[model samples]
Target: MMDRRERKRPAAQPGSRRRTAALLLGSAVLLAAALSARPVPHEVVVQFGDDVSAREAANALASLGATVLWVNRSEGVWAVRMPDPGEAWRLYDRGAERVTDAKSYSST
Candidate 1:
Protein backbone atom coordinates (compact mmCIF):
# COMPACT_ATOMS: atom_id res chain seq x y z
CA MET A 1 0.00 0.00 0.00
CA MET A 2 3.00 2.36 0.52
CA ASP A 3 5.62 3.43 -1.98
CA ARG A 4 8.99 1.51 -1.77
CA ARG A 5 10.90 4.79 -1.60
CA GLU A 6 8.73 6.03 1.34
CA ARG A 7 8.99 2.79 3.39
CA LYS A 8 12.02 2.40 5.74
CA ARG A 9 14.39 -0.54 5.33
CA PRO A 10 15.02 -3.00 8.21
CA ALA A 11 17.74 -1.62 10.50
CA ALA A 12 20.19 -4.55 10.09
CA GLN A 13 18.39 -7.15 7.88
CA PRO A 14 18.54 -9.74 10.74
CA GLY A 15 21.44 -11.97 12.13
CA SER A 16 24.01 -9.17 11.72
CA ARG A 17 23.99 -8.46 15.44
CA ARG A 18 24.66 -12.11 16.28
CA ARG A 19 27.59 -12.24 13.83
CA THR A 20 29.05 -9.05 15.24
CA ALA A 21 28.72 -10.37 18.81
CA ALA A 22 30.45 -13.65 17.91
CA LEU A 23 33.32 -11.74 16.31
CA LEU A 24 33.69 -9.57 19.37
CA LEU A 25 33.65 -12.56 21.71
CA GLY A 26 36.28 -14.35 19.63
CA SER A 27 38.49 -11.27 19.69
CA ALA A 28 38.16 -11.02 23.48
CA VAL A 29 39.15 -14.67 23.94
CA LEU A 30 42.20 -14.19 21.76
CA LEU A 31 43.21 -11.08 23.68
CA ALA A 32 42.91 -12.85 27.03
CA ALA A 33 45.05 -15.77 25.82
CA ALA A 34 47.75 -13.44 24.55
CA LEU A 35 47.83 -11.48 27.78
CA SER A 36 48.19 -14.65 29.90
CA ALA A 37 51.04 -16.10 27.87
CA ARG A 38 54.58 -15.68 29.21
CA PRO A 39 58.06 -16.16 27.95
CA VAL A 40 60.44 -18.79 29.32
CA PRO A 41 63.56 -17.99 31.27
CA HIS A 42 65.81 -17.79 28.27
CA GLU A 43 69.58 -17.98 28.62
CA VAL A 44 71.91 -15.00 28.87
CA VAL A 45 74.62 -13.94 26.43
CA VAL A 46 77.91 -13.09 28.11
CA GLN A 47 80.10 -10.66 26.26
CA PHE A 48 83.79 -10.55 27.02
CA GLY A 49 86.54 -8.23 25.92
CA ASP A 50 88.78 -9.03 22.96
CA ASP A 51 91.45 -10.09 25.34
CA VAL A 52 89.32 -13.02 26.47
CA SER A 53 89.21 -16.33 24.63
CA ALA A 54 86.20 -18.55 24.03
CA ARG A 55 87.57 -21.32 26.25
CA GLU A 56 88.30 -18.83 29.04
CA ALA A 57 84.76 -17.48 28.83
CA ALA A 58 83.29 -20.96 28.88
CA ASN A 59 85.38 -21.83 31.90
CA ALA A 60 84.32 -18.70 33.70
CA LEU A 61 80.64 -19.54 33.14
CA ALA A 62 81.19 -23.16 34.10
CA SER A 63 82.66 -22.13 37.45
CA LEU A 64 79.36 -20.46 38.26
CA GLY A 65 77.45 -23.73 37.64
CA ALA A 66 76.13 -22.37 34.35
CA THR A 67 75.88 -24.20 31.08
CA VAL A 68 77.30 -22.79 27.82
CA LEU A 69 74.61 -23.23 25.21
CA TRP A 70 76.67 -21.77 22.36
CA VAL A 71 80.02 -20.11 21.76
CA ASN A 72 80.78 -17.29 19.30
CA ARG A 73 84.54 -17.48 19.15
CA SER A 74 84.88 -14.68 16.62
CA GLU A 75 82.83 -12.24 18.72
CA GLY A 76 83.92 -13.45 22.15
CA VAL A 77 80.29 -13.90 23.17
CA TRP A 78 78.92 -16.97 24.90
CA ALA A 79 75.29 -17.88 25.48
CA VAL A 80 75.12 -19.35 28.94
CA ARG A 81 72.25 -20.41 31.17
CA MET A 82 72.81 -19.75 34.80
CA PRO A 83 70.87 -21.26 37.68
CA ASP A 84 69.52 -17.82 38.56
CA PRO A 85 69.60 -14.24 37.30
CA GLY A 86 71.48 -12.99 40.34
CA GLU A 87 74.63 -14.72 39.10
CA ALA A 88 75.15 -11.91 36.55
CA TRP A 89 77.03 -9.86 39.14
CA ARG A 90 79.39 -12.73 39.87
CA LEU A 91 80.15 -12.93 36.16
CA TYR A 92 81.37 -9.33 36.31
CA ASP A 93 83.64 -10.21 39.20
CA ARG A 94 84.90 -13.11 37.09
CA GLY A 95 85.99 -10.73 34.28
CA ALA A 96 82.89 -10.56 32.11
CA GLU A 97 82.51 -7.13 30.49
CA ARG A 98 78.77 -7.39 29.82
CA VAL A 99 75.93 -9.81 30.32
CA THR A 100 72.61 -9.62 28.48
CA ASP A 101 69.50 -11.75 28.12
CA ALA A 102 69.51 -14.04 25.06
CA LYS A 103 65.99 -13.61 23.72
CA SER A 104 64.48 -15.31 20.71
CA TYR A 105 63.69 -13.02 17.77
CA SER A 106 61.22 -15.35 16.05
CA SER A 107 58.18 -17.19 17.32
CA THR A 108 57.48 -20.80 16.47
Candidate 2:
Protein backbone atom coordinates (compact mmCIF):
# COMPACT_ATOMS: atom_id res chain seq x y z
CA MET A 1 0.00 0.00 0.00
CA MET A 2 1.21 3.59 -0.83
CA ASP A 3 1.64 6.24 1.80
CA ARG A 4 -1.43 8.46 2.31
CA ARG A 5 0.75 11.62 2.13
CA GLU A 6 1.89 10.82 -1.50
CA ARG A 7 -0.28 12.38 -4.23
CA LYS A 8 -1.53 10.14 -7.06
CA ARG A 9 -0.40 11.10 -10.60
CA PRO A 10 -3.19 12.15 -12.97
CA ALA A 11 -3.57 10.31 -16.34
CA ALA A 12 -2.84 12.29 -19.56
CA GLN A 13 -6.01 13.19 -21.47
CA PRO A 14 -6.36 11.78 -25.06
CA GLY A 15 -7.70 15.01 -26.63
CA SER A 16 -4.97 17.33 -25.31
CA ARG A 17 -3.08 17.42 -28.63
CA ARG A 18 -6.28 18.06 -30.56
CA ARG A 19 -7.20 20.87 -28.19
CA THR A 20 -3.79 22.48 -28.59
CA ALA A 21 -4.01 22.26 -32.41
CA ALA A 22 -7.45 23.79 -32.39
CA LEU A 23 -6.26 26.67 -30.20
CA LEU A 24 -3.36 27.37 -32.57
CA LEU A 25 -5.69 27.32 -35.58
CA GLY A 26 -8.12 29.61 -33.82
CA SER A 27 -5.34 32.06 -32.95
CA ALA A 28 -4.09 32.12 -36.54
CA VAL A 29 -7.61 32.79 -37.85
CA LEU A 30 -8.12 35.62 -35.37
CA LEU A 31 -4.78 37.20 -36.28
CA ALA A 32 -5.63 37.02 -39.98
CA ALA A 33 -9.04 38.57 -39.41
CA ALA A 34 -7.56 41.41 -37.36
CA LEU A 35 -4.99 42.17 -40.04
CA SER A 36 -7.52 42.06 -42.88
CA ALA A 37 -10.00 44.30 -41.04
CA ARG A 38 -7.88 47.38 -41.69
CA PRO A 39 -8.91 49.44 -44.72
CA VAL A 40 -6.68 49.73 -47.78
CA PRO A 41 -5.48 53.18 -48.85
CA HIS A 42 -7.00 54.86 -51.89
CA GLU A 43 -5.00 55.03 -55.12
CA VAL A 44 -3.96 58.29 -56.84
CA VAL A 45 -4.62 59.14 -60.43
CA VAL A 46 -2.52 61.55 -62.51
CA GLN A 47 -4.18 62.99 -65.54
CA PHE A 48 -2.54 64.16 -68.75
CA GLY A 49 -3.89 65.06 -72.17
CA ASP A 50 -5.51 62.25 -74.14
CA ASP A 51 -2.80 62.90 -76.69
CA VAL A 52 -0.54 61.09 -74.22
CA SER A 53 -0.92 57.39 -74.73
CA ALA A 54 -1.55 54.78 -71.97
CA ARG A 55 1.64 53.06 -73.08
CA GLU A 56 3.57 56.24 -72.25
CA ALA A 57 2.15 56.56 -68.72
CA ALA A 58 2.38 52.82 -68.08
CA ASN A 59 6.05 52.93 -68.92
CA ALA A 60 6.46 55.78 -66.41
CA LEU A 61 4.78 53.76 -63.64
CA ALA A 62 6.74 50.63 -64.51
CA SER A 63 9.95 52.43 -63.69
CA LEU A 64 8.82 52.52 -60.04
CA GLY A 65 7.49 48.92 -59.93
CA ALA A 66 3.91 50.23 -59.61
CA THR A 67 1.00 48.67 -61.42
CA VAL A 68 -1.21 50.75 -63.71
CA LEU A 69 -4.63 49.73 -62.42
CA TRP A 70 -6.47 51.46 -65.24
CA VAL A 71 -6.16 54.13 -67.91
CA ASN A 72 -8.93 56.07 -69.58
CA ARG A 73 -9.29 59.30 -71.52
CA SER A 74 -11.90 61.77 -70.32
CA GLU A 75 -12.46 65.12 -71.96
CA GLY A 76 -9.05 65.85 -73.42
CA VAL A 77 -7.04 64.16 -70.66
CA TRP A 78 -5.80 60.66 -70.10
CA ALA A 79 -6.20 59.66 -66.47
CA VAL A 80 -3.70 57.11 -65.15
CA ARG A 81 -4.49 54.93 -62.14
CA MET A 82 -1.52 54.36 -59.86
CA PRO A 83 -1.40 52.07 -56.84
CA ASP A 84 -1.41 54.83 -54.18
CA PRO A 85 -0.44 58.42 -53.41
CA GLY A 86 2.96 57.30 -52.09
CA GLU A 87 3.81 55.65 -55.40
CA ALA A 88 2.44 58.62 -57.29
CA TRP A 89 4.74 60.99 -55.40
CA ARG A 90 7.68 58.67 -55.91
CA LEU A 91 7.19 58.59 -59.67
CA TYR A 92 6.36 62.30 -59.82
CA ASP A 93 9.46 63.29 -57.87
CA ARG A 94 11.75 61.01 -59.82
CA GLY A 95 11.07 62.70 -63.16
CA ALA A 96 9.29 66.03 -62.60
CA GLU A 97 12.30 68.01 -61.42
CA ARG A 98 14.29 67.16 -64.51
CA VAL A 99 11.46 68.20 -66.79
CA THR A 100 11.04 71.47 -64.96
CA ASP A 101 14.75 72.19 -65.21
CA ALA A 102 14.74 71.45 -68.92
CA LYS A 103 11.73 73.74 -69.47
CA SER A 104 13.33 76.61 -67.55
CA TYR A 105 16.57 76.24 -69.49
CA SER A 106 14.75 76.17 -72.84
CA SER A 107 12.60 79.15 -71.93
CA THR A 108 15.66 81.21 -70.95
Assess every candidate by TM-score. Answer: 0.52, 0.39
Q: Pick the candidate with the highest TM-score.
A: 1
TM-score of 2: 0.39
**lDDT of candidate 2?**
0.51
**How well is each residue in 9-106 modelled by candidate 1, as lDDT tens digits?**
76895899899999999999999899767433348888788787667777788887787787764857778777776666788866688787778422
Taking the tens digit of each residue's C-alpha lDDT, what string does model 2 give over 3-73?
86796778769999899999999999999999887644444445443454556556666775554444444
lDDT per prediction? Answer: 0.75, 0.51
Question: Against the true structure, what is every candidate's RMSD?
Answer: 10.9, 12.3
List the candidate 1 regions with Cα displacement exceeding 4 Å: 1-42, 104-108
Total backbone clashes of model 2? 0
